[model samples]
Target: MARMISYCMRIIEIPMLYLQKRLGISRLAWVFLLPNLLLFGLFAFLPVVLNFVYAMTGSDQILLQDRTFVGMGNYQTLTSCEDFLNPNSCKDDLFWRAVYNTFWFVLLQVGFMVGFALLTALMLNSKIRARGFFRSVFFFPVLLSPVVVALIWKWILQREGLANAALEGMGFDTINWLLDRHWAFFWSVFISVWAHMGFYTLILLAGLQAIPRDVYEAASMDAASPFRTFRRITLPLLMPTMIVVLVLSLIKSVQTFDEVYAFTGGGPGSATTLLIQYVYETGFAGTPRLFGLASAASILLAVVLVILTCLQLWASRRNVNG
Candidate 1:
């Protein structure tokens, strides 16, 4: 089998080697790139094209051939509403609920995550005992599979799980962490922040380390307090990196799906359901899949991400100019 595989690979390489000899390096490069370009076209570009095509149609059917073309019908349906302000009054309440949840999720989660990550990065950057160990310990969770992280947190937050058991042991009433809407939302945000905070912390720590030691020494020579040094020197220098982190975290927070889905399943009456989950459940999870609607939702999500990316670029450019 090994010899046969080697023979097949040699057979495949022979034509390419012949072409490399016959053609120029530039042409040979295309020969090498053909497979990857074909794959990218088939998978990435094809799906995006098909998704847009599907989004323009109205279909209960799975195949594009069976679907009916309904120019902007799906988008119109999504936008149809008496009151956009009140999601419950909208035609598609679930979509609006998801939007609302995602809004709060991004706001709260990104806020807390960035704050905590900055604090953690600051500590990790300081001269401290066992610094390498502490850094590794903080970052270990980021290397865990999202599914595993979710499961671990889910087990800890369950009614009879470690959290409640601890409460009972401490002579406090056990609180339902996963069942109630507020608690479910809280834990969802908290767990997501916990799982990914290390990543942002590391980014910030890199930014922290890149600052010149001479700057700190100069600040110290000027009899500057630690707070003043951080405020004036550290923060001002760190703004560009912080902005990058902020934009990345915002985009990621918006696209949150795996961990929340694995842990909460968007449960407790869809209290923790995000826009991505809404798209998934609509497109594939039900008896009658709303592919067109889901496609529309996906396109909207793409638009949001594009806008965010543009804003990030603009901010970066402004920082450069300033």
Candidate 2:
């Protein structure tokens, strides 16, 4: 096997040597990156182009050629409303409800997720017993598949499941957690936070460790209170990482679907229905399967995501410049 590998490499080296001679060392980066670039173009760029094409064409047919061109019609349909405040007034009421739900989900999920992650990161960074074990314990959930996490939580939250049983044992009524709209929305946010907080905590923990110990020593020498030191020193140094966490969490929260789908099935009359669910149902699962409108909704979502990503990039560049 080694001899065969050597022979194959030797055969490949002749062409590589020729190409290196043609391109020179200065351009070798592109040569090294060419395969990945080609794959990205094929998988990433091609799909985006196709999605845009689908957005402009209207039809239930899977074939693009059979779809009729209806430029801007889907977008107009999605945006039109008699009263923007009331979703019932809109032509695409479900879209607006999804939008409204998504807006709240992003707000609550990102806010709570980042807050919990920061707190966990701070605790994990401090001197404590079994610190390594605790870190591992916190991060364990992130390693689980989203489906598995959802199923586990579903069992725990169900009426005849462990949670209700525990409640009954404790002499409290077993609340139907998933049946109520308010509780369903709450659990959707809670489960997402529980499942993903550790990853962000790890990021923030790294940011914490990168701060120099000598700075803290100086603060202590000056008799700074713990709160004062954290506020004055730690927060300033960690702002860049915080910004990164915020943007990433915000983007992830906006795109939430899989775990949510498995957990609540966007249940109790679209209480937990999000934008991605709306798009998925419209594009593939609904009776008519309005591909054009679904594509347009996804396009709108992509635009928001692009704007968020650009914000992150801008912040990073500014942080670096300083």
Candidate 3:
């Protein structure tokens, strides 16, 4: 193994020596970066440029050259509606529905995810049996693929699954959980929180542990109750970490797809459809795929994400400064 490594290093050194002489040492770094730069430009930058271009064009044709320039026609169509609150009144009703669903989903998911994460962090931070074991168990779900998480929940919530089975065992009639619009939305938020809560919990736990032991000791010396200690010391100290978690979870909730997609398929008659799913369906899944409309939706979604990204940066900077 050592000899094989030496031979490989020798082969690599030959090219490095040759390149160093040709490009000069300082400029040679660009050679190594060239491939990565090209890939970034091709995959990231080019798609962004094309998305803008596609947003300005019309027609169902996939190729850019084939599509006719329609200026902001796609954007206009999305915004064209008599009653903004009433999706049925819009030109593209589905877009408005998706926007509303996304709004609620983000609100509910972010709130519950952060709340439960903080609660779990508090519990885990306390002296308890199998604390380390429980921490590992909580975080294990975060390791699973989003699709896998969705499928697990989907099976458990289905008609004949354990959820219904439990209900029936108590003499309640078994009913489909995923087929009801309200229940489907509830499960979507619940599943999202369950899969991701551990991650935020770990962050909050770190913040909790970082609170100086002396502070808690002093609080105890004053006979501070648990609630008082938490409100005065723990909550204030944990605020920065909570802000970080809030921004991150907000972004993730806005860009929600994959798991929710696999779990509900934006179903119970488009009750759970989000902005990202709307983009996917418009661009790829639907017949006569409206690439222009999809690109416009994407641009809108990107704007929201950029705002959230800015919030994240501000929170991160503040955390570092303090």
Candidate 4:
């Protein structure tokens, strides 16, 4: 009977040891996660919280001073106030114009960028010679810094630059690419599309490559034409990637400041003035900077981006289900 009791005790002790080992493994997994969580909280979450706080108070002008709590006063000022940086002040027409211009810029840029990316991806995915070299050339633009791309295009589009010189050599009249408002906007859009299309192309190419070859072969066996196969199979499978490219391009285009600032400086009567540029000009351009107002505008921009991202996510989910 004592021997039997000893065997039962050993059985119970074995399970306890197994449970302890499992717990130890779980703790080790969590230890690996902790560092990433702490870094994300410190860098991303904390800055967002601070931005929210700064948006509610008048902090731009008095950085060192204690800011007055204004409730939703800053937001209210944004709705009706003309000056983006000053809600207490009257309306400013330039602010609204900048908003309109930014919308146009986003619409044009996203449309062209995504359309061209899809086209290039399709071309690159074909069974053509020199595919590797062509793919590399197409993706080269994305590897360059945005500032560098803008500067290179700036030189190319100048009055007596390569483009105009080529046109003149062809016996065409030299066109003022940057001086005229319409032409300046055109060049900006062109440069943005050229510089960005490569990244999206590479993304779409990856999506294309992931699609199994057997699917296309099966479609062909069923007497499906190339166009029909693409319309029915390729497009549906690519929807997720398309949605990603669209959302990213839209957000970047809407928040466009660096390239525009470096190229146009929001010049020629505010022709290329984007929303972010307006915020910068309002807060930092003049003698007395309006930090509170700038913060409000920044919050508004963030809200817009969040809304668009949510919409894209919903659309992508629907596509996947359908």
Which candidate achieves the best TM-score against the true structure? 3
lDDT of 4 at 204: 94
Cα TM-score per model: 0.89, 0.90, 0.91, 0.80
Every candidate's lDDT: 0.93, 0.93, 0.96, 0.83
Candidate with better lDDT, 1 vs 2: 2
Question: Ranking under TM-score, best-scoring first?
Answer: 3, 2, 1, 4
- Mind sharing the TM-score for model 4? 0.80
Identify the superior model by lDDT, candidate 1 or candidate 3.
3
**Cα lDDT tens digits for candidate 2, 1-322:** 9999999999999988998899997897799999999999999999899899999999898899899999999999999999998999999999999999999999999999999999999999999999999999999999999999999989999989899999999999999999999999999999999999999999999999999999999999999999999999999999988998998888898999999999998887889999999999999999898999999999999999999989889877866875
Error of 1 at 82 (Å): 1.6
Backbone clash count for every predicted candidate, in the order shown: 0, 0, 0, 3
For candidate 4, give the lDDT: 0.83
Q: Can you tell me which runs of candidate 3 are displaced by over 4 Å?
A: 1-32
Tens-digit lDDT string for candidate 1 (1-322)? 9999999999999887889889977888887788999999999999999999999998689888899999988888888879988887888888988989999999999999999999999999999999999999999999999999999999999999999999999999999899999999999999999999999999999999989999999999999999999999999998888998899899999999999999999989989999999999999996589999999999998999999898789878876886
How well does candidate 4 match the true structure, expressed as C-alpha RMSD?
A: 7.9
Model 2 — which ten-residue stretch has the worst lDDT?
313-322
Error of 3 at 183 (Å): 0.8
Q: Any idea what lDDT model 1 has?
A: 0.93
What is the alpha-carbon lDDT of model 3 when measured against the actual structure?
0.96
